[model samples]
Target: MAGAAELFVWWVLAVVLQVFLTGPLSWLEWTVAAGAAVPAAFGARAVRRASGAGSGGGARALHAVLVWPVALVADTGRLASLTLRALRGRQVRGRFQTLELGRGTGAAWACTLLSATPGAYAVGLGRGRFVLVHTLPGPPGVLADALTDGRRS
Candidate 1:
């Protein structure tokens, strides 16, 4: 029952967001549509149960949608800058370094942020003690600063 409720809520929220973006539907229409979606939420639980998955699909989907745009913009800027530098045949120094991160989900979040940004990628982890990252121009310190501050890290 909980799973169904979760699924319904996810679908309704998705519909609401779509209506908001499309802007063709009036608020009353959106509200009505959202209310109607409530029953479909149960389907989410069934899908998860059938797949034997534990994670909340709705939350994951929402996170992906939210993060992807930010990642794309950051990557685009990085690629443009790198391209400009490459045109001059500048010696692009690259750096590989490990960073100690707080345990658990924070580490994952940090890695995602780094991987999404341009000219940087989280390649691996070592000793479960640090995250390994590769960066162009060989300034691991700058990258570290960004990551630590929750900006580009």
Candidate 2:
């Protein structure tokens, strides 16, 4: 079941990415996107199984899905600002912030969502609630707050 879900999700996302990032696409491009999604999807499933994160979650996964769109846009804009600054001979200031993380599958999902954005990458998960994230310096975005689990240490 998880494998099916992964495959479906991957296929959908790949198609969407190709369509959005490349503008108008030909049938061959669509086929390539779909063909590429299969192996990636299975690989994700295999990793999840090996890591014991296949247990998944309920509302938490839904929440991450909801938070994703907002975070993606905000992070992209932040990276763009950083790029503009760099181009104008200004220093690009990226920083690391430790954010609170949940346990088990929740932690994995949170990290995945946080890392998907351009401005932030979930660098490592330390002992306990330490999720080290490298991101462009800015006010905490909605995703960080969502993943923080309302506990700031």
The weakest ten consecutive residues by lDDT in model 2 span: 101-110
The C-alpha local distance difference test score for the whole of candidate 1 amounts to 0.57
Instruction: State the lDDT of candidate 2 residue by residue for 35-138, as single tens digits.
Output: 88777767766665675544355666677778878889988888888899899999878788888764433566577778888867888877766778887787
Clashes of each: 6, 0
Question: Please, what are the lDDT tens digits per residue for candidate 1 over residues 15-96?
Answer: 7656756788877888876776565445544554564434433443444446655655655676678778889997556677
In angstroms, give how far residue 42 of model 2 lies from its true place: 0.4
Supply the TM-score for candidate 2. Answer: 0.76
lDDT of candidate 2?
0.73
Top lDDT hit: 2
Best candidate according to TM-score: 2
Error of 1 at 75 (Å): 6.4
Task: Rate residue 135 of model 2 by lDDT.
Answer: 78
